[model samples]
Target chain A: MNARLYSVVFTFVLTTIFVLCLAGINALASGTIEKNEQLEFQRSLVYVFNIAEDIDSISDEKILSLYGNRIEEITGDQTVYVVNKDGSKELAFAVQSPGLWGTITALVAFNEGGTKITGIDFVSHSETPGLGGRIDEVLFKEQFRGERISSDPSARVAVVSGQDTDSKEDARVDAITGATRTSESVQILLNKAINSVLPVVREVVE
Target chain B: MAESKKTVFLANIWKNNPVIVQILGICSALAVTNNLTNTLIMGVGLIFVTAFSSLTISALRRMIPKNVRMMVQVLIIATYVIILDIVLKAYLPSISKALGPYVGLIITNCIIMGRAEAFAQSHGSVLSFLDGVSAGIGYSLVLLAVAFIRELLGFGTVFGVRVMPGGFTPWVIMIMAPSAFFILGAIIWIARTPIVKKK
Candidate 1:
């Protein structure tokens, strides 16, 4: 009985020590980690704006300076980021849709007119790597640039296949060859973002 | 008794590799191996979690009640994995984003649990710590090897730099998960030959 009690006490003490050590390490790294996340968000914002400069080459201070209080968050039924470029407004909003494996969350930036996609960046996703995951790659994302949303309320952005996108003026993106499901999800997400969030922003901006 | 520590360390790397020999952690091995850098970071992260968790569990082995042992073990492992996830998100946001949900999935990795139950439970704290590190290194080495093959063939590159000749056409299939299944199977086959022969 004495031996068993001793064993129990020993285990309790050891587990306590382990937990404390991990807590200490986490505390130490917490500040740097937070700063990195902020910087990354800033970088993503810059990319959506089609800023040609290198994101990392510029310091966080510079990114913050460029941002220059131009960004605002809407507090309402849905959260949206409002960025003013001169008198015109650009609104960045988050959209979530199901991918092949799991949910995908993206930050989509649209011009005030809601006619053009200013920029887009994936905030989070769980798509299959090297296939569905290529949506996060710059080359795939670049296709969305300057895409004009069709004015017809009934018509949505169509992700087409095996066709040359000669008409950049149309808001049609060529879906990735092998990632039909993931590409379809992106189209669905954009449709939701445009229909639901764009109307809200249009009211605020107009 | 002294030699036992040395044997445990060596055994994890070759005779009982967690990925190749035991065939654990195949999911991340397939998912992240498309890029060398992500694969390396994932391996390092796993090593850190496995090593420290082993040390902690081994030290507490005597006191934890047998009835509640698995629960406590999971709790302990989860805490460390969360710490790893937080640190990565804070410091290496890009890599962290690339890694996605796999970092969280480390808690469910069988190797960490296997080590805690099989080795840490029976061993002293110091020996168990070494065993954990050995197991992690063993896992990392095999993953790196698989990553090397996958990245090179899939992208025609190493560590994201283009390496194939100008005229070379990259194999698109190499980038997919099915390719990893084939490559890993080949590796397991080759690795098991000597062991089978010796037996």
Candidate 2:
């Protein structure tokens, strides 16, 4: 009985100390961590709007300066980031929606007229690493660029792994090979962003 | 077992190698071997955790109660893993994001627990740290070999740079988890053949 009770007490004390150590480190590093996350989000916005041609090669200092100089941040019903591209202002907003494993947050951008998609970027997602997670890759996001979305918007972009033999010109993007669930989730979120978010974005831009 | 430091380190690196011989840490070996860069990062992270945890466990071995020793070792190991995760997130966010849940997945890796129980519990701090580091390097060598084949075949690229001829086609099978199983099996077979012959 004595040894058993001692084991319990020993484990309790050891666990407490170790957890405290982790908590202390996390507390100290939280500020820098928050700053890095914000920087990544800003960088994603720049990439999504195609403000910087090569988002992968840009330096951290360059990203900060470019964001400061070009991008405008505004919040009303939802937070939005705007950048001037070609001639007029282009707006990109964060879309939080459900994914296969967990919440998927994507930043989608539209041209000044709100009829064509400028580009899209994933801010965060909880999906399988190699398979579903390819949504963040350049090939997937590249498909969204320059695709038209009507103001009334009956037919929008369709993500298909196979062929799309349609009569009308539907903006079709290729789904990732192995990640069918993630591709479907992305399709659902894209439609949601169109039906719900696009109207407010159009009103704000125009 | 009054072992020399040189013998101890060399044993973990080759003869008593963790991955090839003991067949430990195969979970990460399979999971992160698809690309060279992620595997390198995972290897370095494992080294950092293993070395420090071994050092810590060995240092505290005398003080820990015999009945609760495993629990204490786990606590020490987990603390270090969380610290590594925090450091990665703060300074190297892109790599951290690329690694994703794999950073947290290091906790469940059997290599750390194995070393803690086998070497650190009986050995001195510095020798245990050396053992941990060498074991990690051994694991890394095998992972890098597997990743080399996987990345080359999967994308016809090395470290994200195009290496293969423009006309060459990439094999899609190399991009998936099952490919790693095959490549790793081959690696173990080749690596062990040498040791078996020497014996």
Candidate 3:
């Protein structure tokens, strides 16, 4: 065999064997990976709905149980998760908004009337850790819990830095310091969620 | 051969450390060092990829055509990295998420390729594996040190546990990528002083 031809053949053969091995491994792990993702999404749903306490400490089975018993998935123009809370129906939906580095996908919940946010949990984001990534911290997400959403589409829920306001009616939350772009992204994200997705979700609920 | 297994292994950790000496893999060293947990996981992931890839490359050194050896080494390295990513997704979803693209980026870490081309090409499988592991450890040691400072000052935490006093002011700069450069530079400077003096 010519040396060049042999090299090419060897490379091709090696690539095929490696790709096959990767494919086999991926196939074997895909099921568990999918299940893990599904469970994570479910856990985030349960968290955003505020149906459970200390969600991090709860077992996977408990989360599955809570999701099963309390949450109902409604697929319409937008997929929404509905949970009956204290005799009132609340809705939660996934929202994708651009962060500094990449997309920030969050599960955002709304109150029974869609007038206020009930809770929020970030499903995935690529923001820099300890800076923009602080958006995932409880201190940041907790501000949205029961925060009033303004009727004004432009500034539905204001995420401002150095704000002294703590009133839920103001719909304002302090953004993480040193993360100005991410803070603005959060404001933009909320504006879109409130102005666009909420109406569609409300229609779906109706 | 005076270059025994111990020297091959120990050289990478200190005398010829990948991060501080050879200066390979500084990209990930800077990128993932902001958080201790993430840095630790990244270190382990890099070690896993480097060790296996080096072993595989050494085992096939004779068979790999010299002209196409680099391509073959990359294929082997990439296979292990993807497998690590898949396993992490299946069993450790949260860490997997935190590490995110850095796991996939392990294929591009220069340490694995450097070991493959420099040491593995001429070494035996077991010795090459040791070289790979030690190189990874050398890289990890520097990264973890950098992360320890960053996480401690930036988040007032160690491995996510709050360790600082209640009023300790967190330094915002420490949380960003620039801080890694300063820290890593200082580490390299400190680690190389004695070696430079002897030479």
- Could you tally the backbone clashes for each prediction? 2, 0, 0
Error of 3 at B74 (Å): 1.2
RMSD of 1: 3.3
Interface RMSD of 2: 1.6
- Kindly indicate the candidate among 1 and 2 with the higher TM-score: 2
Give the distance in Å from residue B114's predicted Cα in candidate 2 to where it truly belongs.
Answer: 0.5
Instruction: Please identify model 3 stretches exceeding 4 Å from their true place.
Output: none
lDDT of 3: 0.91
Give the candidates in order of lDDT, highest first. 3, 2, 1
Candidate 1: tens digits of C-alpha lDDT, residues A70-134: 56767676777777777788888778878889899888888887889888898778887777888
Candidate 3 per-residue lDDT, tens place, A1-206, comes to 89999999999999999999999999999999999999999989988888888887999999999999999999866899999888898999989999999999988899878899999898888887768888889889989999998877878888887777599999888988889999888888888888889888888887
Q: Which pairs of residues collide in model 2?
A: none
For candidate 1, report its TM-score: 0.86
RMSD of each: 3.3, 2.4, 1.9
Cα lDDT computed for each candidate against the true fold: 0.81, 0.86, 0.91
Q: Please provide, for model 2 over B1-199, each residue's C-alpha lDDT reduced to its tens digit, 9 standing for 90 to 100.
A: 6798999888888898888999999998988888899999999999999999999999988878897888788888888999999999998887898888889989888989999999999999999999889888888888899999999999999989989999989997898899998998887888899899999
For candidate 1, lDDT tens digit of each residue in B1-199?
A: 6548879989999998998788888878877777789888988888888888889888878767786688778877888898889888777877888888889998988889999898887788889889988998898888788888888887889988989887878787777788888988898899989977888
> Over the stretch A113-157, how does candidate 2's per-residue lDDT look in tens digits?
767778989899988877898898888888788876644444367
DockQ of each: 0.39, 0.69, 0.80
